[model samples]
Target: MNDECDFCRIVAGEKSAHVLYEDERTVAVLDQHPAVTGHSLVVPRSHEEEVLTIDEATTTAVFETLRCVADALETALDPDGFSVFHTSGPLVGTVEHAHVHLVPRFADDDVTLSLSRDRLDPDDAAELTARVRDAL
Candidate 1:
């Protein structure tokens, strides 16, 4: 286990977390500094720096656990919506582990969508859909 990584420490049972869900492949814990109430982190059991490093089985397990946590969050908090994001760039200060942020948003919440003038056109949207579909 990686001693310096917080998530790794949590998985090793060396640290405490408000864990809502846990399986052989993943663990879901409530965020200490949550943007909104019920915010949580879905993390893989295996330590990996980025999503690209996680194998297919571990990736699938992460999302499966995420879906379960999202459902429970919706039922418990009844948030307006939710956002699932993974930090990709070095500037984001992500830990050397593959994890997903499951943040619940309320109707009057402070969260804002960052959009730009260079938005996708209709053709681009169709192509994007096709590309994403092809991946599945």
Candidate 2:
């Protein structure tokens, strides 16, 4: 583990974090500065500088853990929806380890989407979904 990384500190129990879930491969914890009430972070136990740097096994494990935590968050918080995102830039204020952000959204909350009043057509959405699935 990198001694300078915040995630490393948390994983080492050298820092305080509101942990949600943990396993051999990953850990989920509440975000200190939450975008929503139930905003949380999902990270791998191993320290990797970026998502692309993680091994295939670790990457798969991280995503699987994320899905489980997301389901639990939906059931527990009952948010209107949620978003999962990851940042990989070293200068973007992202920690030096790969992680996913799970931000719960409420209908009346401040979190807003970039999409305007014009909605995507169902066919377009279907095509996009197909492309994403193909990529995966």
Report every candidate's CA lDDT.
0.88, 0.87
What TM-score does structure 2 among the candidates reach? 0.79
Q: Estimated TM-score per prediction?
A: 0.84, 0.79
Per-residue CA lDDT of model 2 for 7-82, tens digit only, reads 9888888999999999898999999998789899988988887877799999998889888988999999998888
Q: Judging by TM-score against the true structure, name the best candidate.
A: 1
lDDT of 1 by residue, 1-136 (tens): 6889999999888999999999999999998788888889998888888876789999999999999999999999988889888887689865777789999988898876564678669998999999999999
RMSD of every candidate to native, in Å, equals 3.3, 4.7
Per-residue error for 73 in candidate 2, Å, reads 0.7
**Collision count of model 2:** 0
- List where candidate 2 sits over 4 angstroms from the true fold: 113-136
